[model samples]
Target: MESIFHEKQEGSLCAQHCLNNLLQGEYFSPVELSSIAHQLDEEERMRMAEGGVQTEEYRTFLQQPSGNMDDSGFFSIQVISNALGVWGLEIILFNSREYQQLRIDPIHEKAFICNYKEHWFTVRKLGQQWFNLNSLLTGPELISDTYLALFLAQLQQEGYSIFVIRGNLPDCEADQILRIMRVEQQQRPKLIGEDEAQRMSVQPVSDTPVPGDEAPLDEDEEELRKALALSRQHMEVEDEEADLRRAIQLSMQGSSDPTSPNAVVTAGSSHESGSSEETLTAEELRRRRQAYFDRQQQAHDSSTAGEVKDSGTKPNQ
Candidate 1:
């Protein structure tokens, strides 16, 4: 499985990044996902308005850092699943709290989206191990089953929602799934909370945008479009050499700043020479530094050899 990180982007879009990784071949840019999310939010608002259901709680939920509606970063699982359907994929969602209902055996080759508090991440099982693709990490990290269970329990305790997705389906199947979701959505009741009712009784209904209305692109959307264009250009020319160069640069930067987020953390490793709360001794730190440089040299030589091999394979014009 492939893992992608949010990189320098704001934390609000971790879910968007996770989705991008999940549907890798589809190439749905973050901008496109954000647009779909915004449209879905608008649709939900319209539904609430029609049903005379005040949307204070829902609006609050959207405005939170994890689900910033204005930034087009956060999204509900239903909205995401619906958008995936539009992209020609079938999504099966499972509430994480109900472990018995989860089909872990069939998830071997599938993507799993996990939600924890205000953060969103992904994990996948390969063989007997699980790899975490949390956006905050530099790369996919190995996670133990014990850690996974504890993490899920913590999320549940925090009143956070969890969803597991099984995606990528045949076009015909996707169409059928989308139709079913639409029917279910229409039949779902829009419940009005007592607080919402009391608040709405004193205030007039807020004006809502008409369904299917097109709005001009905002600043955030414009920036996202530019980013997506640049990303496409990069993807067109990306190769192993480019990856090696990036890896080397990141390694150098991390070495130069021991306090950097990318710095290697050997806290719980069997080879850890220092305690988590203790600083490394001078000799131990030097040894680590030497080891890092040795790895960098090996990678540099390998990348150079690959480049030479590729050049030799090219036919003479």
Candidate 2:
């Protein structure tokens, strides 16, 4: 979970300031970026969870080599030269459109295009980061890694510094990276209201501490309880959504079949030996299905009657 509005404010501000500073020619590059690049393995020279790797469709982007390999290789050499006292390195990616491109796709309804680059490693914020892109790639897989280094090099040429840090670092590398860069940490930024924030901040605690509570919970206990309730309710409203969608699709298929103009019975009966090709009246089939569901619901309700009553009872001396 990420807080787009709250968590990104600092980075967005930093990026803006960097842009402004670059405009005024107030940029300075540390000579050590190349030295830092040398300390990193060829595998570590990439970004994490890049969309190109996750989505099969975008994978083709990494197959072609960029023309700046020699320049990137030179940049890597320079980073390795100044590797001392470096705490960490991150690759900050920005799409060509910058923040304006940040959007949630309506089809998937997921947050995307937040970074500046069209691909992964577009935003490299670094600290205590441990990821291995090498294991996932077969052969050299040079295009992605090469272009990533090249991109950082370009940013460096534009007055941005990129380097790797040495020694152990914290698990919360993102926050740690910001902190190292003299940035403030954001606390659960997605929480909109004070009440929401307070609710999330509080955890359930028991007044009485049970001793020897070291044993793990019985794996089946909670699962069994839930399963029993699900069986008893027979209401499976959640499951009905998918079934309804499938039924609609089947109905459409049946209606479109030229042989059965109005409707056609789908082959393959789900239960027992029954009429496989016998066309059924739409109304009749629906009634039968409803009756079957009703019977299951009745049986479930009866079986869980005792538990339902127990749940409503008050404790007595």
Candidate 3:
């Protein structure tokens, strides 16, 4: 539903986004998660100091940066686990032997925190539906019950560490509303900045409205090829028509340049083979343009019919 609080990606604050989205509100901020990370770092530092202050390992660890966080605003999973603990929620490693032994289905879980590379996101069950609250997405992605397990498995395959959230999530308007009535997504949301990136590409936009579901295959490429050809065809027609019109206007103005290449004089002849060519009058040019357009239309219709036949579908029209 529209009430879902989705934070579009900004900087490397995915950990902040992940926790806040999981809690279904702006429950946590960068400062809060960073504080948690620093605390974890201090604890690790004190543990290393126990190995004796002068030890090689302790000195080497001191020289290195904090493992719990980095300059890019990334927080370790330990930080996330600790942050969730603040809400009385337990975090379980999904792939751990103890949890895997239970044979529990992922769809029944209330929430999941997924991490890949350094990006973090939440796949949470709001009311009766599950939504992928990835900060990189334009908005919350509705994941069908049947596809939830498959989606998690795909993330796991792609080297993501998935943790199960075991507790009641904070109350939110989206969860309260979706529980009463379901919402269906007609079109999936694109990734954040995806449309803008596409607009910046070098390709000129086509006049034809391409179907959104067009496959990226030979068929789609062939259609684009036709569109390019049509673009060039129209450009050629317009240029020739403009030249003829200029000659027509000049002729009516009584200052026509008869020797000009585009001028439509009363007579014309070629000496090479003693052959003759008709003067290209304005009326003749209009007739020729109509004929040219008719030929183009017939060619386009034939191409469409051939494509429909090849695709093994009945022509609906």
Candidate 4:
């Protein structure tokens, strides 16, 4: 994980992260991708001009925003394709007829780029194994060979468009070592803000609870406060919101059975947790909120500790 290059999410710049992760380096940036988008926009404008720049259609097109890029740092698939073309790599849609005809399994591919809504991510094979190199996660998630096909199927079910990366990938250390002596993961990585929730869920019974709250907080309350304050400097809220939406969706699925005994969830919070109020208890909702903040706290602490060690005031642990 340490050897693999990964860029955490910043604003809505996932397209940039997706490209770099696919190539296994800082091979792309928001500025570079934006340039690609602008070039694409220029090409499109040229085509529209062929249709006659003096026409109403061309006039309207000039007034509209760039279809290839947005103010929030989003770049369209066209921009992503162009950027990969620069690296001599190409993308093949996983669900395309041409891809289906090839009968190539997910693990057989070198890398994948997935898009759901506007968020972009990479799942690439390094060494002899597959990894979900999503920037929304705390670290690279090791994927077993047997599970790779199932994973891609699940993503498609979730409305993600998966593209297989084709061509020679630039060499990197993680791939070389893993090709020889492979490493085994004792635990899987969680979504970036999910670790604290897991820890809180399994605390010993002796852990103290926050006053006036049903969920246990113990020292977690302090951590949350620290995290909330540090967020301006250390984290982006977009990815946390995405995780929250996912958790709520899972909760809704669990509570979908109206006939089930546990189906009655509280109404207001249910809007955010999922449509079914019965899905997440108010206690669970608080815990999920805690998880979001706990993520920020961890990132902030890690950064601060690094600065301290660099100053020679603290030894590297």
- CA lDDT, every model vs. true structure: 0.45, 0.30, 0.70, 0.69
How close to the true structure is residue 132 of candidate 1, measured as C-alpha lDDT? 51
Q: Is candidate 1 or candidate 2 better by lDDT?
A: 1
The residue ranges of model 2 lying beyond 4 angstroms of the native Cα positions read 1-249, 257-262, 270-275, 308-317
TM-score of each prediction: 0.39, 0.19, 0.64, 0.63
Cα-based lDDT at residue 209, candidate 3: 59
Worst 10-residue lDDT window for candidate 4 reads 227-236
lDDT of 2 by residue, 1-317 (tens): 12111111121132222211211221213223323443443333244224446665445444544322223223332232233224242222222223214431112111111111111111222321111111111111111222232222223322233222223322343344534443322221121132443454464666675553333325543342232221112122223333332332243333433123234434333447543444544444444445656876887877677676879974354
Candidate 4 lDDT score at position 210: 46
lDDT (Cα, tens digit) per residue for candidate 1, span 1-317: 22222232354776666655454333455677767767776776666566455568656554555332445466666656766677665444333224324434322434566654435566644334544555544344544443344233223323335455555533333233434332111121111132343454565445875454345556754443332221111011122333222332223222323333334322121235643232333234335444654766777779977887888874345
Ten contiguous residues minimizing lDDT sum, candidate 3: 227-236
True-vs-predicted CA distance for residue 259, candidate 2, Å: 16
lDDT of 4: 0.69
Error of 3 at 249 (Å): 77
Which candidate model has the greater TM-score, 1 or 2? Answer: 1
- Give one digit per residue, the lDDT tens place, for model 3 in 162-239: 789998788999999988988887667766655655654545677775455233335633443332221112211333
lDDT of 1 at 78: 60
Query: lDDT (0-100) at residue 67 of candidate 2?
Result: 22
Winning model by lDDT: 3
| TM-score of candidate 1 against the unseen true structure | 0.39
Q: What digit string (tens of lDDT, one per residue) describes model 4 on residues 150-217? A: 35544553446778899998999889878887777766665554556666557666556644334445
From the highest lDDT down, the ranking of the candidates is 3, 4, 1, 2
Point out where model 3 deviates above 4 Å: 202-317
